[model samples]
Target: MIPRFNDHAANERTYLAWVRTAIAVMAFGFLVERFDLFITYASQNASRAAHKLHMHLRLTEWVGLLLIVFGALIILLASARFLRNRRDIAHERMEDYAGPVGEKLLAAILVLLGLFLVVYVGQELAALSSQPDM
Candidate 1:
């Protein structure tokens, strides 16, 4: 039987969870980055004057790209953590995670993204409501 099989299994499970999260984040980023397509399609039928209106989500583009970058970073971080955790599990006493910086950074970025999206959406709604009907 493998020694400390439960600990090893738990470590593997945690690593897998991180991988899943990373994939999800990347996928969501791709979706957000593609918002440009929707905007273009929407503007296709708009009057020439409407075309001049500023309706683009420039910040959203940056956020989406950042998310994709973060997702890749997550994979790297998870792999490093998994390896370290595995090594620690082999010792008589496991040491604390050296710097937890990656996870903390990810959390902080996500929170900022969430807040930006909220404010962006709210502002867009207000602008839409204020505009005169076409």
Candidate 2:
């Protein structure tokens, strides 16, 4: 067995966790992009076009695509980090390892995205409420 096998295992586990998270992000992006299609189908089935009080920005579709790209980037970075960390562990140079900078950045990005989503939904609701009932 290699020295510090447990440390290597831990690194592998972290890598797997990041991979799972990336998959989830990509899946969410796919769902967001598909929602427009879902809405269109629903409207068509209803036999009447849905009222649009405000112009549809179509931002969700772009945001979803960006999310998928970000997720892909995350996976790539995670694998690289995993290999680097594994090498460090093998060399017993763990002290040279930087902290979780990428993870922190990812968290901050997610938080900003969440805030944007909240604002967008609030504006949508406000617009809907101001419109006259059909």
Candidate 3:
């Protein structure tokens, strides 16, 4: 009757951490999307070129959407992993830890998202610098 409380507790803690991270990512994504919408609405009275520029700054919207979706996927992954870990610990088969394919995929996606954001910010700065002083 060996107690596996420590193993189960650690697994629960990891699962909770993952959920918290997912929530933060989703909230940030929503904020980004909402901020873009606010900008678009607020610039409706601006000149034609300004409106065009705002319209062209559409990448944030897409990035926000991708982040929200990715957060959801992370939640699902975390849930599945948690259940699998619990089962393995109960059965004393800890040797069969889940594979790293999903984690690798997540890391790759995160890298791509970060790169996209960097490029997007650079473009925005360039465009802003080109504009005449108000």
TM-score for each predicted model, relative to the true structure? 0.80, 0.79, 0.80
| Ordering by TM-score | 3, 1, 2
Q: Which regions of candidate 2 deviate over 4 angstroms?
A: 38-57
Q: How much lDDT does each candidate structure score?
A: 0.77, 0.76, 0.76
Q: What tens digits encode model 3's per-residue C-alpha lDDT throughout 58-125?
A: 75777788799889989998999999888889998747555788779878988887787678667655
* Error in Å for residue 7 of model 1: 0.4
Q: What does candidate 1's lDDT look like per residue over 45-90, in tens digits?
A: 4433453334455656777898898889889989998998888888
- Which RMSD does model 2 reach against the true structure? 3.6
lDDT of 2 at 51: 49
lDDT-better candidate, 1 vs 2: 1
TM value for model 1: 0.80
For model 3, what is the error of residue 93's alpha carbon versus the real structure, in angstroms, after optimal superposition?
Answer: 2.3
Winner by TM-score between candidate 2 and candidate 1: 1
Over 1-134, each residue of candidate 2 has an lDDT whose tens digit, in order, gives 77888998999999999999999999988876665664454344343334441133367678788889989999999999999888888888736547778879999998987787678667655655565555
Candidate numbers, best lDDT first, in rank order:
1, 3, 2
lDDT of 3 at 106: 76
* Model 1, C-alpha of 130: deviation from truth (Å): 2.1
